[model samples]
Target: MRTVRYSNREELEGINSRPFLANHLRTEVAVHLHSNAEPSHNARGARVIVQPGRPADARLAQSVLCSMKELIHSVSVYADFTVAPAPHTGNKGENREAKMPSIIVETAFHTNPDDARALQDPVFRTASMKGVEKGYRLFSEGKDCVPLKAEPIDGIHLSAGGSQQVDVAFEGNPQYPIELVTTNVGCPPGWTCTDGRVRIETPDTKPSQLTLRCENAGSAPMFWNTQVVDDDGVKSPPVRHWVQCIRGPGGAVASPGVPAGVEAATAG
Candidate 1:
């Protein structure tokens, strides 16, 4: 095997050198190993970053994540997507520009003392290599890497006529994006749903579906049920969420202009 290295701060100059290595030598896949930093000092876990919608890349990422999870035994790990968009541009330059399917392996958070210690262990790195091996085997044979499913995620609250974001958890390799459809028949006027698909950037994270809005509040609570459809045309059982505009201290529905203190209260 041949090894190539990038100079420090090469990215600062807009230089992506990893592609040159792959072009010069015939390679199957490229793996970029790295780490992440969280705002919270206690955040911990390992996640693989891959190009979205690429089955082989996704499988490889899932494999690394599952393997690392077993090795750490304590920290949670999952596969994440490296989507091409602003801020992230989907992923690091190495993965996006490579000649072959590529992914970035975020070992763990250095800010977390526990993870920092884990990063120093030779066994930890070994586990990562093993994970890649496992994924490579499946990817080569066109095996199923991740199971498919749609998971309703935490709901966001909004005042009547206001908008809020809805999201879902996705699993498995999908040839298409996850579609969200409102199943509630009583969705009142001003009720509109947009951005009907789950936009995922990584694994172990929820994908935003769309904004839910209502034109007005009712004397009673309003209900909404959503159907999540996966890439293979598989549909998840309807998931429910709701919102009520509070009129006063009690749980009564309020008029459009009533002040919603919303104390210790959550709206679906």
Candidate 2:
């Protein structure tokens, strides 16, 4: 999986303008699409071409093209490139031998408002990561996994006040149940843990220390965990092993976190 950002015509030229074509045929590549970065006349959208091989060329090309079509259809944001077999040999030797599947992703248009906004969002950065993951999954596994959605957390508005808390959530195949635990052996004077909950008072005082752990108790388990940091430059120990337990059919378990609506909000 590789991410190549193409912001201008010069960069695109560095790629397309390469003197040698045979040596540059990459098995996988994604060029970030941009319009304004290059002169309008210079921009040629994006193109993905599959070359035919001996025995399985036709079948592989068809499968790849179909998958690309599905990916374009599934997402509302990006446009799909016209996919076809390579036409010219260019400077390279006869364009025979199965050329690896190639895709060029055009990401931005200078004139489009939506494109302008997309460039500024962290979500857009994440989209690139997802694209790379999808490309590898498709090329190797012949299937693409559905991308996970990231929840929006307003970091600026979350206030710790004088208390500290950590939350955990689980969602996946129901067969698995997740267990979360936290241990506080060196907590400050007013900090305590009871019934799987840790409470901290005197936000101004530095904690002697704290530790957290998580584990799953099911056939198939998945784990997810994170940490909390305060205003001071102190690093809190990460909640360890927040494992997901695959419960039996028709089983359920609880998630960690302060009850919903209990979080205090601060002005941004």
Candidate 3:
């Protein structure tokens, strides 16, 4: 849910630090998304890589893979799930180093023309992300559960060290008495989020709403994740809400145009 990097240009934090930070933040499941490639340019499919010999990691991988396979044009889903060893030597990175379950999702092969075109389409990109969300829900909750839905609040403009109370509405007429909580995904360094309870004045007659407070101490654009949890412990898919901060002095928005680090911050 929370992204390690907001832009492609971000490189201040190296790969070795990702797993360490994820562990420090105590993330539930770490998912690294990437596009695949091959020399033959004939290979095509969505693949998930997990740490070797970890059942929990494999379970997470399969759950995500099952949902993603339905929406993507993959020749193979890699049902078995690929188990990857530690990257290089001294310090393990990403999947291998995380304390929690982790997986790498190779959505498609850019090397293949058909897959490359699909990845470029906006419709396809949206659908693919939906699959990942559903897959995550399946893992967190269960297959038979009705996944909760909330639209993402992205690209909010705020001042550095400023706070905002965001009102998020549920997608459908969900049942009452659901609690909203921050997901395992984390916030950027120096940021803080205070979660709120869901309130519905009219029950099923209208959508439920949750008003949460977010404070950004740094001048950067970042996102955090939250999900709806029912009384039975079933969780809805995670929703990533983003905020862009402006410089306090000049009131100029800090652009995500340059590389920067987005480490974990406080959340409740």
Per-residue lDDT over 178-224 for candidate 3, one digit per residue giving the tens place of the 0 to 100 score: 66665424445544533334433344534434333323444665555
TM-score of each: 0.42, 0.30, 0.43
Error of 1 at 115 (Å): 0.3
TM-score of 3: 0.43
CA deviation > 4 Å runs, candidate 3 = 1-13, 73-92, 142-268
Tens-digit lDDT string for candidate 1 (1-268)? 8976757666733436775577567688887777779989877666677766566666666665653443333222312312111112255666767778777777678888877876787756565555556556657666744534457545444554454555555555543455555544343344332222333343434544555543333433556566655443435556666655432332222111112232222233
User: In model 3, which residue pairs have backbone atoms overlapping below 3 Å?
Assistant: none
CA lDDT scores, all candidates in order: 0.52, 0.33, 0.56
| Higher-scoring candidate on TM-score, 2 or 3 | 3
Question: What is the TM-score of candidate 2?
Answer: 0.30
**Which candidate ranks first by lDDT, i.e. highest?**
3
Deviating ranges (above 4 Å) for candidate 1: 1-9, 12-15, 71-89, 145-268
